[model samples]
Target: MTETTPYDADRARFTRQAPARLVLCDHAVDVADGAAGLVATEHDPDARPGGRVSQAVQLLELTERALVSAVIYERERGSSWAEITQYLGIGPAEAEKRFAAKLAGWDTAFDVPYRLDDTGRKRIPQLPTAAYDPAWACTQLDRWAGNRLILVDNEHPVSSGLVMAVPKT
Candidate 1:
């Protein structure tokens, strides 16, 4: 037999004067029974940019890397370094040199022919997706949720995944 909940009396007395409501991130919550129409807004006021760096900044860097990596794959798949580098908002020549080296390193390590940089031919390497499409990841941040950190999708790796605050219930 299952034990009875002691709040049986309150269960019968439960009656909400208004529809259930929720306040999302950075929003104010109206207290259902606070004195005189009480409303309160909460925030993560004290930010500890601790550990020598904040997670917010770290996440941004990771996203940028993921974007670069995805662009590299796109280049290997036929996109041009000129186009990709321009899209990445980097100085064409400088970014080209930097990215070419990165892709070549990946190719040598993986023994794949995706990168042709050593041949003086600029091309993309079929790296194992060292990063993900940054734009796709950024879309998920269109909304502000709670301060709690949570992964948006588990199956997708962090390079391809997203992180956001928990939704306020």
Candidate 2:
């Protein structure tokens, strides 16, 4: 089961702190194809070697932004800002300035509780088995910040693991 998975997890539950990026990525894009899409998009870049690295970093930032908002949505449910910041790999002050304060402007509806039971106790939220609509996440993603979500597949062996986001038009 784990072999076929795009992500490797150390625990089955979502911790009080933010889960690892691969785990969260797997959780956000639930469809196997979508997960594959994320992976594909992550690797696909029009830029050459140096440009490719920059683009990849941008895609990474986009993923972090989406994941941060997702975690913030969960925080509204009961999680703490401290845990979210930790997951974001930032300190409280920086988190407050760049992340936590942005929640009011973000789309709250997508901030659905990815977990239903106790995350810190006996029950932890596991990666979603359900499929997610890419077009929908794309459109909804626009609401969050004009950022885009992309997943492209080709005939080659390319496997992307990130979604690119740009400022909204």
Q: Compared to the true structure, candidate 1 yields what TM-score?
A: 0.36
lDDT of 2 by residue, 69-121 (tens): 46654654465667767767777677767764555533231233233355633
Cα lDDT tens digits, model 1, 10-42, are 222321110000101101111111211212324
User: Can you give the lDDT of residue 30 in candidate 2?
Assistant: 37
What C-alpha lDDT does candidate 2 achieve relative to the native structure? Answer: 0.40
TM-score of each: 0.36, 0.33
Candidate 2, residue 64: Cα displacement in angstroms equals 2.7
What is the lDDT, from 0 to 100, of the residue 44 in candidate 1?
A: 32
- Per-model lDDT: 0.37, 0.40
In candidate 2, position 18 carries an lDDT of 25
